[model samples]
Target: MSNAARQQSSRTGLLAGFVLAALFMLSLFVGVIDVPFHRALADAGALELLLISRLPRTLAALLAGSGLAIAGLIMQTLTRNSYVEPSTAGTAQSAELGVLLVTLLWPSANLFAKSIVATATALLGTSVFLMTAHRLPPTQPFLVPLFGIVYGGVIGAAVTFVAWQADLLQYLSVWTNGDFSGVLRGRYELLWIGAAMLVAAWMIADRLTIMALGRDASIGLGIDYARMLQLGLVIVSVISALSTVVVGMIPFVGLVVPNIVSRLMGDNLRGTLPVVAMSGAILVLGCDILGRLIRYPYEIPVGTVMGCVGGIIFLWLLFRRPAHA
Candidate 1:
């Protein structure tokens, strides 16, 4: 990039960092309870509430949002399709299915076990998706994401059917709808694993960027294509699984955030990944805050708010073609 463009990108990142900081502060003070910052610092009970509930909820939102957005960017890079993400692809549904299976079979399983199973299943499901999507004509770019949606629906239906038989439909509902309302300090620490995966992605960012050039070209460029492919799948699957297991499946943050960041900053993953992560954090945290206020004393799930908002953005992206196209 030219120095001018790099300077502009730096300015944008700095501004976004400020916005994220503001939102983070706002989140701490926005719940139904009136725990003023000063009061929380002064009173032990108020401080406990802030630390145990509010802090964890906001941090979970930040981790899940940024992690899933990076996962989506990796998915797009691997598939060479902009529209696909964990929710639209089979990744999130597969993770849910894994959690359900573990719950049914080992009713006494721990969170770690469930996360492992979910990540494994997510990796499998995503692999299947890529294999099938690869068969579709690239000329018709829309076909890949459409197929992914149908594929995910099939897995989700299986989850629903099993849950229905086991009288665990409520479990299915909770897993399918993302919400941070139940987050507490101990419960949400698992999402930090997603943060670790984000670091892993950054370490291999250049390899991922090259891998996006297609298998033959990437191999010619000295990238171990198959190994990089597995690495990407592992990162995407683990993040999808952790987020789904911890807070349920929050959709569209992945799909929407990366696309917007890519549009503004261009597709060099090394340069753009931070912006994507920050944008995702801002979007999800903002939506979570909106969900809280829109209902006042009650609350809507973040998934519901994103479904409404992200759905509109997705539609706009679908019809908005480039001048070259």
Candidate 2:
């Protein structure tokens, strides 16, 4: 709350914004098409490509990356678990199951309908994870995410079994990997829902901060602990569901980016939210661009790249941190 702290937070936020903007520009340039930026200004074909493909792709990446990261931070704070996030905590897998079910039963359901089902499933799955974690002793901090992985695996296995039986394994497979290649104009509008949730989260950041101080503490502080916690979890669930429904599952943007931002900016969600969101967007955009250029045409999925990178980062966090974490 001091002047120096405010200035530091401002600078960190500004830096994140700069990085996000630069990456967005780079993302527009790095694509399958070989249009020069100079020519795109005047040429019809190039201009159209920029508007239809590149603009949408950039927005999708921005939304997916930032949304998941904010979701992770919210879960971490709510549960007081450093490792809990959409991917590790089974929220994304749960959403994936919802998508699979809708595809199998309805077969012709629109994206909004699928997203609705996916969001409900995700909320249920995340609530189960939190309840299970809540029942365990506080001594074991890592057990929460470990249980999440097992819980998610079981849910994922059930989904896989159904997909195999129904001969929709390929459809299920496509949603698990995160790629921006399919992000055309009409396809990616669902992601804006995720963006809206982040704004909602910012609006209630202070209440969530109070809720994070343990139920007893929040209650003693005259906060409606249960209501606020549920609201926060709902927001997280919606973000997880919409991101999965819109662009498939992109892992580690939630886990890695939020952790890094927390380390740099401290635990104040108000100060760190924008930075965390921006860092997530910047990191994903960088990875997306790398995926595009690495093979010159046939691009790697952004989820795969983030998975590999995030796995290493996760290992480092697992090994290098002190026992107190």
Could you list the CA RMSD of all candidates, in the order they appear?
1.3, 1.5
lDDT of 2 at 116: 96
lDDT of 1 by residue, 1-325 (tens): 6787788688988988999999999999999898887797999988898999999999999999999999999999999999999999999999999999999999898888999999999999999998898789989999999999999999999999999999999878777999989999999898999999999999998888888788889999999888888899999999999999999999898898888887777788888888889888998899999999997989999999999988888778768855454
Superposition error at 48 for model 2 (Å): 0.7
**Model 1 vs truth, CA RMSD:** 1.3
Lowest lDDT sum, 10 consecutive residues, model 2, at 316-325
Candidate 2 global CA lDDT score: 0.87
lDDT of 2 by residue, 1-325 (tens): 5677678889999988888888898888887788897898899999999999999999999999999999999998888887878887889999999999999899899999999999999999999888888887779988888888899899989888989999989888578888888899999898898898999999987777777778888899898887887888899999989988888888888888878876666777788888888988887788888888889889998888888888888788767775456
Q: Return the TM-score for each candidate structure.
A: 0.97, 0.96
Which 10 consecutive residues of model 1 have the lowest summed lDDT?
Answer: 316-325
Top of the candidates by lDDT = 1
